[model samples]
Target chain A: MNNSIMILIFIISTVAGYKLIKDVPSLLHTPLMSGMNAFSGITVVGAILTTASAAALHSKILGAIAIILAMINVVGGFYITDRMLGKFKSGLKDK
Target chain B: MELNIVNIVSLVIILICAADIKLMSSPKTALVGNRIGALSMLAAILFVLIYNDIITIPLLLVSLIIGAFIGILFTYKTGGVKIPQLVALFNGFGGGASLIVSFILLLEQGSNIDTFARFTAFSGAIVGGLTFSGSLIAAGKLEGIINQKPVTIKAHSMITSLLLIILLAIMIFGTVIDDYIVTFASGATVLSLLFGVIFAIRIGGADMPITISLLNSCSGLAASVCGFAVGDIILISLGAIVGASGLILTQIMCKAMNRSLWHILTGSTYRKVIDSSTETIVEIKSDGAKKEVHNYLEIVNKAKNIIIVPGYGMALSQAQEQVKLLFDYLIGKGKDVRFAIHPVAGRMPGHMNVLLAEVDIPYEYLCDIDTINPEFASTDVVIVVGACDVINPEAITAQGTPIYGMPILRVHEAKHVIVCNKDTKPGYSGVENSLYNKSNVTLLLGNAADTLAELISQLQNDLQSDTVLQD
Candidate 1:
């Protein structure tokens, strides 16, 4: 994608996101923060590509570390968020 | 030219993400909504992997396995009290990953990278580095490894401004300088990381929730810029969504505290003045001098209506389960019971609610400040379990105080207030709670879980004795 087009998409998506999250109650803010943290882990794509295609050893090492960190962010973030959200029950029986 | 299938799929995934976030607002569908969000992330990853055809299967599989294993183990092993720290750590990891990736991309492209790409990569590196180090400091503070009080040095703003100017100069002149791309990028990263530490350490423990939200937004902004550097549409869209939502959440948190974002960012919100008079009152309670021991069981037994206020200390002592038992016992005795939750009561947003929900407390019994504050005046008794600032009446009664104008639960309005904490020590704000000095408030000092357990057994024994007398 061209740079200008990408910037346009960024602005539009951000506005859409702001509208979507406007009504979230304070009770769910923790889960929302963690869930969004996981989504930002999309950097794993850049990590994988960089690591796999690196022509030098140092570059490869940096890429590997990046991949590990990104994966951790993605996996841990989503799982913890799920665990937190699962605790919220409408009735007492689920507990 | 025909549209690529991957682009279409990416658009669909972004739409799914938007819907998922919207559904997460309600408790009933929050779990499902979170799962769908995760699935959308997975789909985006797969799209990128297949479309780019960058298949180093062995390396990919190994990294994924190790990362997933560690992530799962850490998340499950961490207790509820440490969830805030864990979230902070994970957020830092995300930022660190983007920082590394952007730096590697920049090094590879060298001077051949376009101006726009270079700018995005540089911004990503700087923001990612700041978020990475800043969040680590936040986690350290929450974990008690670092001091919770704000640490400031003279002329800190001057130093920060100087660093900013140097970073901007490097970025602008990098293209003109021969083979200075690596040096300039590294310099920018280091300077930003230093700024992150300065920025985070200046905010006290009381403002951590808002700080965490801001850092979460920073990581999202960094990731989105990385997407621009790498030319990935899915990454760009997801990152933007996270960035924008996190910013909105930060604003909401600021409003909850009745503080401005600028006030928080400038690190001027934490007041250093300690009211000496309030300290003397706390000393009287803790030193057992003229200590009036009001029997909590006796008072609770006679009360027709009761309210329980839980806070971060409740989570610290793992008292929610015991609190639940007490709630059930009170209801069994035909007493009116409800929970009053302050919006910023816990370390993170909804911390107390999550703790109570874990122990099977029904959702309907939990009430926000607006809903439950009006009832406090008519309530027979208010039992505050490990909460301090939220119930501290100084927020309304005292002017020129740090917490003034911040809406509280109005626990002091009840006919009687029973405060349960380990000690009369000040709360996160480092100021003594003026509510403790009120004549109607009685102090019960002990671990929250232990005190609540004792209260429950006492109530049960009282009930059995009453039955014996009747028989």
Candidate 2:
């Protein structure tokens, strides 16, 4: 993707995400923040591609470390969010 | 862009994640939404491996396994109270990943890289570096490893401004003249880290929710810019989405506190030490402690409609379980009880809700401030558990105070008030609570858990004595 196209995608997705996330209740804001925090780990894709494409060993090593950190962020963020969301239960049977 | 397998797969995964966020609107579907998100992440990783034919890379597999193991271990051990710090730590990791990736790109591509990619990489490095360090400092504060009080060095504003100017110069000049790109990126990374520490260190405990949310946005912003450098749609779009979500949460927290984002970022958060000598001591004397407890119990027993307002101190003292027991006891006695949660109550947004939920308090009974404020007027009693600033009547009455004009729960509107706090001290904002001075207010100062325990026991003893008398 070219720079302009990439920038366009970013703008469109940001607007879409802002709209979608607005509907989330304040009750679930913590989990929502953690969930999005996990998604930020999508940088793992960059780490993987860059590491695989790099010619030098040091560059590859740095990419691998990035991959590790990003993966931890992804896994840990989702895990904690799920745990927290599971606890949000209503006592009343209906609604 | 041409339609290809990779593009199709990336689009599908992005949609899945979007649907996941959409499902989060309601808690009922949020669990499944989170699962779908994780699965989509898995799919994204798998696709990247197959598309690149790097599935056989031992280093990649090992790194992933190690990362997942550490992630699970940390998440498993982390309890509800530590969620804020854990999230901050994890956010730091994400930001660090972005910073490292951007640095790698700069080193490998050198001057040969296109100007746009170079610029994006530089921007990513700066944002990612700061996000990484800022988040770590925030986590430390939340974890109690670092002082929760704001620590501003001499000439803090001047130093911060100078650093900002230097970072801008490196970013702009490096893109134009790529010969010293590596040196510039390294310098920017170091300076950004320093700036982040300075920025975060000066923010006090009560302002954590805002700081965390902003750092969360920076992490995403870093990832998105790195995506532009690498020219990948998934990184760009998903990162942007995360970035926007964080920004929205930050705005919500700021508005809830009635403070501006700029004011918080510029280190205008409360640092005043309230002068206790001049302030009137409305707190009940120690000699009258027994009478105060008796008075609180009698009023609590007679109250039919009750509201509990919990704050960060409740979490600090691990009193939620005791609060839960109190809730159960009240419910058994047929009292209408609900929790009034301030938007900025705990260390993070929705933090109080999660803590209450952990103790099995029904989400239905937990009401936001706006929803519960008017009801306070009709309430028979308001029990404040380790909260101050949120319920401080001074927010409405006082001008020029740090908490002035801030939105607060109308605890004073209730007929009677009982505050179970550690002391009569002002809260994080350093503004004395005027509610404690009201005639209807009963200050039950001590550890919240202990105070609630004694209150429950007193109520129980009264019930036993009444039955004995009737028999």
Candidate 3:
């Protein structure tokens, strides 16, 4: 959780992600994007921490809104991605 | 030792996510991969709840349930044609969440917050606010709620630059001065949101793929910076991964269109709208047109191999079902049929494939431009359904046009070409489609759904009579 370690983790994860996504064919780019959208919702963790540690009522209310939004992002993104990937069927096998 | 335990657990979760992405590379395993990803998210949330001891927070639990319900409802109601808009909308939600978190941290941290945390909080606010507003505009445009054409006021570029400079100044002031963090941070947030509007307003619909990808990156970057503000490693690593994936997709879309990302972001490629009268409409079934359709029909009946090229126009007309019918009909007749999808064919990357798949067209029949380009020469007929720029020979032949040097499907190389489009007007680039003038091409201009239906019925009648005659 140190600043230097956080920066190091970011760099490593970014590079690994860049290499990993390169293998996904263009055929699934839309689903790939939506799935990443879900991951970005990891902000909900920060939202919870911020809300819990807040000293004032208004700040807690704002943090709760953030939690709701991020939850929507995580749940909706993954669910829709699953829906899309499910739709992709092999024609040869189906026949 | 407790911190080590936390770090080890976080690393395990990150590994799970990485494996999930690896599984997404193939269709067969992507469904399981997505489920695994959802599970990983759930685990991360539960881990945070237990570690932070926030499980007793009634408001958080209520909010989660409400958010989950809304999310599921929205996704369930969204049809295939509207997937891009839905993605953009949800992406905006993620950005907005980061912005709110950053705002809360900035306001509540007081004297104990370090300079690095304060700086990252400000940075997160800026990026998050911009992504939130920018993505909403993008979603609106995609949904037809806002003008799809670029809306530019006088000195648009100059105004955008001024807003950006102000936001940067406010961010710096909030970070360095610290005395008026509340006031300066609020100013920066508003200005950043304004900048998002200015940034997205001048981008036309055709440039949406790049804009969406770029905004996707900004949302992730925003979350990562928020993690830096809070010193959370899980948010940092996951956000970085999403950011990198978005950047890669942006680069791919830019390369496919032969446009630099900078030009797109700066709206350098945008020009004033041209007059609609300049578009030439070659009506269907005129004396000369009749003869061309007849020739195209004769060629289609005998053609052994066919490739169907679909564009955004196909989506606009909602003709995917009709296209499916044609595909089925052609395949039934023993013709080797394939669909050629240009990288930027629809509003986003791989949009055409998703649309085709929604109608039960198999993934095997969908081929990217690179894979289908070489086969066009040997193809007996190329059928263009509601597409223009991707198949326009002007992309390769003409110089100084907007589409010059951009990759096309090489539909012209086929022995015969049948174009079923709304009109002979130029595509999003406004460069004339030289393919329309080619000798071997036949234009059937109308609603793509109607034109395709006519083509199918014509083929059905012709082929049916031919079989009867042979019998």
Q: lDDT for each of the candidates?
A: 0.83, 0.90, 0.89
lDDT of 1: 0.83
Across B1-471, the per-residue lDDT of candidate 3 in tens digits comes to 246767888889999999999999998899999999999999999888888888888988888888888899999998989999999999999999999999988889834688889889999999999999999999999999999988888998898889988888877778888598888778878888888888987888788998999999999999999999998888998999999999999999998888999898778763442334244553333344333446577689899999999999899999999999999999988999999999888898889989999998989999988899999999999999989888888888788877789998999999999999998877788777778876678888899999999999998888788889999
Best by DockQ: 2
TM-score for all models, in order of appearance: 0.92, 0.96, 0.96
Question: Between 2 and 3, whose lDDT is larger?
Answer: 2
- In model 3, the Cα lDDT at residue B324 comes to 98
Candidate 2 stretches with Cα past 4 Å from truth are B273-294, B469-471
User: How well is each residue in B126-203 modelled by candidate 2, as lDDT tens digits?
Assistant: 999999999999999998899988898999888988999999999999899958778998998899899899999998
Listed per candidate, the RMSD to the true structure in angstroms reads: 3.0, 2.4, 2.1
Residue B367 in model 1: lDDT? 87
- Model 3, stretches more than 4 Å misplaced? B1-3, B273-293
Per-residue CA lDDT of candidate 1, range B5-68, in tens? 8678878988998889998888888899999988887777676667778654677768867877
On lDDT, the stronger of 1 and 3 is 3
DockQ ranking of the models: 2, 3, 1
Reproduced native contacts, each prediction: 0.76, 0.82, 0.81
Q: How large an RMSD does model 1 have? A: 3.0
